[model samples]
Target: MRPPNTPPARAVSTPAADDTPAADDTEFRTLLDRLSDKATADYYNPFTTFDWPASIPTDELWMSPELLSCHGTELMDELSPAQLRTLSRWESVNFYSLNVHGIRELLIEVTRRVHTPGFELPSEFFHHFIGEENDHMWFFATFCLKYAGKIYPDRSVKLPEAPRDPDIENFLVFARILIFEQIVDHYNVQMAADRRLHPTVRHINRLHHQDESRHIAFGCRLVRLLWERLLDRGPDEAARHELRGHLGGYLGRYLTTSIESLYNPAVYRDAGLPDGFALRKRLLVHPARQAAHAKVLHKTTGFLQRIGVFDARH
Candidate 1:
């Protein structure tokens, strides 16, 4: 079943020659082709890429302390080192679980659109996109299963239904992809660099970030191309307005849900906290946490606003 508020799966019409991407859009097609080539060359077997120790070392942290669920708050200070370590490992599992589920949804979106009536050259890159996403899902799920005993269930963001116009629908899907990659990349880089973490954990973060860097670059360029088309093509003011509202609120809700995943009852319970949900509420509302959330989302939100796709006041 489709999760609440998550974007509905799109159904694309059979491709036709007339619907091939415009010849004049050479730059966009060329860029995607170039990126696709890079992905192929950079491919690695996630299963064998990391030296997964027979057992993950419990002495080391799994994530950067600063990126912890309760970082910068009184709740964070309340934890002993042992409790903090447990939280770090569980939270790392939660993070990877989100990536696994997010990639699952992304695969659905791109699989349907690639080679459809409206896609042609870009379909070429969609092949790379889909391939890379599959690898990502595998590594993330594998890590969770091997180290955490179970993968965290998807409770991140709930997307709304798809938009009526294909242009708007495409825009939103790519935008969501961009949002997800950027946020996850933040954790990847931070954890990858933290020497206190296990080698396998660091390798996982580093490897994923390397791939995600390309993904994020492609996402930015693709969104820009789509935005230019929106400017020149259809979707009247009313439609644009509605999409803008959706983008703003969708991102707002996405950020909220992503952060809330940190406060999962399991993380707290594992960390030895008696009442997980109560502490979660308090941490979420903390002044420091609020600021941190805004900071985490700042760059991507700014980019969307600059492109005129997101209107916060709308």
Candidate 2:
């Protein structure tokens, strides 16, 4: 909305007067040790992580039925338990396929920064972040390929990358990263703890959650740090307006698209539903489905609202 290259105010970082070297170093080491140690013990090779089951059992539900897009609707209830199991398998495949796609996009952005200058302090943790994300992509893709024979391709049209003032670019990037993590985390935490899902299905979710917990923590802190620095460089009128608009519009699109992306017609077609695309379209606007989406994003939405990233109207 604003013209590009708005000049920024002088930078002002958070206070550090009481923070002596010993105290600061102690806290930094604690976080570093936590991530490094987790990588040592919790790391997995996608090639051998799970004894890939010969097949998804027909009788056992592969995903919690309640988590489905059509869940709680008359349509879902109409299906027999056997049919529900079929849907569960298809839904799980679709869900993990999404994880793979999202991981790929974020990895590209993270990789670009990890190797560049100015990331020295956090460089060690970035190694763990990159490695964990790579492993996640592998395991998620493995499940879909093994069970569904293919990962669902992303259908969203790629929009041209938006231009941002260099001063606030880092804030926007980390904000995007944090929102993405928080949204998916809604599912990862639930499914990881959901005993109803198959062992292999739950294991992958559990592993992903374990690694993502660290990423989410790091993202939250980093976003706040960047946000404070951006605020310190007092923005011009145009920059201030653009920042507000970006927060609202960016959050709106993130929440809406993240939910919409889950509805792949192929998933319905595989479950033997006729007119899969039509059903997907119908379910997208369904009230119950919309409510389910709200549930998924409740924590994330609340967090953003608290941080002023999303306003009351949002």
Top TM-score prediction, candidate number: 1
In model 2, the worst 10-residue window by lDDT is 1-10
Q: Model 1 clash pairs?
A: 5-159, 5-160, 6-159
Model 1: residues with Cα > 4 Å off, grouped in runs: 1-24, 231-243, 312-314
TM-score of each: 0.88, 0.85
Q: Give the C-alpha lDDT of model 1.
A: 0.75
Q: Report how far residue 17 has shifted in candidate 2, in Å.
A: 15
Error of 1 at 314 (Å): 9.4
Q: Give candidate 2's TM-score.
A: 0.85
Error of 2 at 197 (Å): 2.2
Residues 1-314, candidate 1, lDDT per residue (tens digit)?
A: 11123344332222346756554466666777778888889988776776777888876788899998789988688888988888888888878888888889888877778876656657888888898889888988988998778987765545566656677677767777887888888888888898998888888888889888988888887777777666656469887676567656765676566667656777778767889878888888989988887777787878887888667652
What's the C-alpha lDDT at position 224 in model 2? 61
lDDT, candidate 1, at 235: 65
lDDT by residue for model 2 (74-188), tens: 8987999898988888888888888888788777766666745545445678889898888888988988898779988876434334455654655656666777777777777
